[model samples]
Target: QASLADLDILRRTRRMEYFRIVNWDNMLYPQYEDKMQKTIAPDIWKWLQSEAKRKLAEKPVAHPAVRAHWQSIVDGIVPFGYNVVEE
Candidate 1:
């Protein structure tokens, strides 16, 4: 059986490899962003923005500073599977 440290190293290595494979074109190709941008319809993009804003509005924080900070945290989240990426 692998040791804890060995398993941890393997997990990190595999994660790196997975992202490298998935984002290879985005990393190497300059037109990747342009192509991706073109694929998102304007109406869909607008709807997404509106939905995000509505979701944020639903969770109201009383203080201005707290609200701003909370919004920043919410905006940074990317949903993956059943959970958002912690980082």
Candidate 2:
């Protein structure tokens, strides 16, 4: 029973290696940004971005300043020079 389990594990490992080799160059990603840029006008995109931000800002948070502070940290920049003061 133990030897059978070991053989099963080995077979699975070999199958995984074969799949990795086969899919080495089979990469794919959606060109959503390119498609949106080509289809949507620049001003429309900007308006969409502002609307999304407004929606995000409307969400309830215990500490709005702290929330924005941490979000700016995650974004690695203080967007629009908006200062976030810690409470």
Candidate 3:
């Protein structure tokens, strides 16, 4: 069973990974430029900046199953189970 401390560490690691993935200044796919210009060009940069700031300030929320499992472990009960299924 993972302790709360362990879960917190994992959460921080995931947050760092997320930040790394989204930390790009520009979109990589130039092929999508035309579509982006039509749909998002006007406010895309402003929206991105606001979202980055908001996400940076936001706290990560654990999944309900994960939280239940943690609590169950703490209470010495049959802990909830989950799988990290990646496609």
TM-score of each: 0.29, 0.26, 0.23
Which stretches of model 2 miss by more than 4 angstroms? Answer: 1-38, 61-87
| The candidate that achieves the highest lDDT relative to the unseen native structure | 1
Which stretches of candidate 1 lie above 4 Å from their native place? Answer: 1-22, 29-39, 62-87
Instruction: Estimate candidate 1's alpha-carbon lDDT, on a 0 to 1 scale.
Output: 0.48
Backbone collision tally, model 2: 0
Backbone clash numbers for all candidates listed: 0, 0, 0
- What digit string (tens of lDDT, one per residue) describes model 3 on residues 1-87? 566566567678766322112323345777655333312232433444454445444624756665554445334342223222222
Please give, for residues 15-74, the per-residue lDDT of candidate 1 as tens digits. 632111134567577777643332333444444446556656885755776566545545
Whole-model lDDT per candidate: 0.48, 0.46, 0.42
State, as a TM-score between 0 and 1, how close model 3 is to the true structure. 0.23
Candidate 2 clashes between residue pairs 3 or more apart in a chain or in different chains = none
The superposed Cα distance between candidate 1 and the true structure at residue 51, in angstroms, equals 1.2
Q: What is the C-alpha RMSD of each candidate to the true structure, in Å?
A: 11.7, 17.5, 18.3
Candidate number with the higher lDDT (1 or 3)? 1
Q: Candidate 2's error at 85, in angstroms?
A: 38
